[model samples]
Target: MFSLKKSQMFALIISSLIVGYTTTMINAKADSGYTVVKRMTGNNANVAYHLANNSKNTYLWNGIHTKAKANLRKYKNYSWRYYGKSLILSHNSKKSLYYYIQGITPNGNEASKIRGIVWHSYLTPGINPNYKQLNNIYYRYFNTDSEYLHYVQKSPSQKLTREVLKLFPNTHLSIQLTKAADGASPWAWASPRVDGYKNILEFPTVQKYFNKRFYKPNISDNTRFKLIKAGLDKSYSQTKRNALTQYQIGIYYYNNPHRLIDDEAPGFTIAIPE
Candidate 1:
């Protein structure tokens, strides 16, 4: 629901262009024989080399948090959501062999952490798949400490698009832009109208509770409430408010935007995609 001002949008566009240009330069300078796979397509020399070198290695299966595992198993049994064969699940440390061999990290210590799983053509096609399963599992399994769960090595933006296409071809993907300074936590406080308790609310609940409480005239609390209501009403129409609420729910349920843990630690469910 946080919007970027004109200046901020301009800056971000410029920065993205710079990054794209830099990536092109880096690829050009690489060794002559190297086949540079576009990072956005998840086809890179590094990913190809890893797959080729580690074809024989065994991958460990690290099941999602208890809840997510149950859900996945149930889905596997009942729903025909997954296509192709499921790859062996493994703990990140065990998977370190592939990354280490690829020279992604210098040592096991550096490699042993939560990372997106890269999928092969058999499981997924087009670009390198940076698996979000781990992040989802961590949020579900360890709900309270989900905020502390940090993912390492995000897939590049271009590769991310290809990965999405591999999973859901012909889908129209919409990016809902929000301000960078909105903080990772989606829920924030509106200044309190009540004297003692803080008027804390999640984005979805904001509209439902808007302007419901009446503060006494001449009190500063009343003035603050008016200001807040004006801001919310002015910035977001009812339809836009609904959309933003849905977006927040997506963040909470799937992406774990604030990384809140649910009943099961490291559990995951398909978030309702925007």
Candidate 2:
């Protein structure tokens, strides 16, 4: 074997380091998988995931692309590297249920189809025990067309929250705050329309109402509840949902009561004891 020059050796070392870093990141994401399925299906409410054509040997790249027609000799026909294996797609029908994938490459490029839908079996189930699952059957149907990815963002929900509050001026926000102060999870507080039930149980109707009010799919019931839950417990334990352990949620509610309704802002306000 011949020896390399100093400059060549340095370049080789840098290339190895770069490749190692990239591999580590990809392995971390792939091995752990993602909790793309948010388990908070409300009765008759729309969920994030829907059944689409099954993916067979489909590759999910760090970007999006369909099978682009190109000269195989001139360009690389497929992605050089992909994070997930056997990526699938959901049908574009308005009536079908779809899955919500977090932390994906945004703004689909021309190279590939949006990789929103993955193999249902590939995902880990029962990650969220507090919420119920939605009805969806997984089947591998080949998609004939390019796919598009869509999701609910915060501004739209905030607009809906503002609109609903405008229609129903009187809500149990104050009472809910009091309950939170008295050692109740904000999600644990129930309303009169619902029989002493709070949180995920109470959110479906609200989700349905907002879905109609907003004239589009709002966030999932579980996701919406968790948003509120997360806002309350933002700075505290990343795991536990209790108010005592994470006083930040109490503070968030006390100061920014509107945040609970507005799905975007996070503050420690409502229930913190002075």
Candidate 3:
């Protein structure tokens, strides 16, 4: 019979118990949290899928294509992990596909380029206006106007154009207003100085000017400072904030739904089963 010292035996038993408990706890925690669902390369699917699937109601940043692809491999085939309200996807690729989602009313023609294409036109039912020609028009008008000709000469619109290009670099601004009830005449009065064109100016040119200027660099230091300043001053209005919040919430929920769950971690794990 082998006789072991009481103190030594007791210590061994306690150490074994502690090890067991720690292992159990770690495993339990790992099992209780979120799970990864699908992972794929850029060659597999579009970013829209992930945006449409996340449950944390988070927004995607602009230019997230590489991150999305890296995430594909990191969380391959529905693994389990802990993710808070959001997960950051990262990648090493040069091409990124993240974009800001926006909804345009059929008749809002603030952006000259998008006016004919994206604005409410009979030709395209739900399309928003394109800004290509409007951009060209800006340059054209800038060149022709003595007051703004300096902008045209220096291509002040370049910064704004680059910003717009970020949204859709390849987008074509080819839509024509020829289909309007007034035909091409609706577009003939693109300039405010042109008389008898007040009907076509129903849409605010100031709004369009701001829209174009929004894409420009150092807009605050440039021609649009006054308008932007004025808008910012009024942005605190309850009505405006409420509307903005509502829109943000709608977008958040739309992008993140309950049905899309990480396979490893389920929604039930986060919220107590009620």
lDDT of 2 at 205: 25
lDDT assessment of candidate 3:
0.24
Q: How much does each candidate deviate from the true structure in C-alpha RMSD? A: 23.6, 18.0, 22.6
Q: What is the lDDT of candidate 1?
A: 0.25
- Model 3 alpha-carbon drift over 4 Å, by segment: 1-50, 55-69, 72-188, 191-208, 211-216, 221-274
lDDT of 2 by residue, 207-240 (tens): 2222222322344544544554444345433233
Model 1 reaches what TM-score against the true structure? 0.19
Q: For candidate 1, which ten residues in a row score worst on lDDT?
A: 72-81
**Best first by TM-score, ranked:** 2, 1, 3
Per-residue error at 58 for model 2, in Å? 12
- Computed on alpha carbons, the lDDT of every model, listed in order, comes to 0.25, 0.27, 0.24
Kindly give the number of clashing pairs for every candidate.
Answer: 21, 29, 16
lDDT of 1 by residue, 1-274 (tens): 2355877888999999999988754553331231212223222221211222223332212222111111111111110111122233234323211121111221111132323322232121111122232232211111121121122123221222232222222222221110111112322224312122222223332222212122222334234334534554665444544443222111112222233222211111111232
Compared to the true structure, candidate 3 yields what TM-score?
0.17
Better of 1 and 3 by TM-score: 1
Q: Positional deviation of 190 in candidate 1, in angstroms?
A: 3.2
The digit string of per-residue lDDT tens for model 3 on 30-51 reads 3222222323333311111111
Point out where model 1 deviates above 4 Å. 1-97, 100-187, 191-250, 254-274
Candidate 2 lDDT (Cα, 0 to 1): 0.27
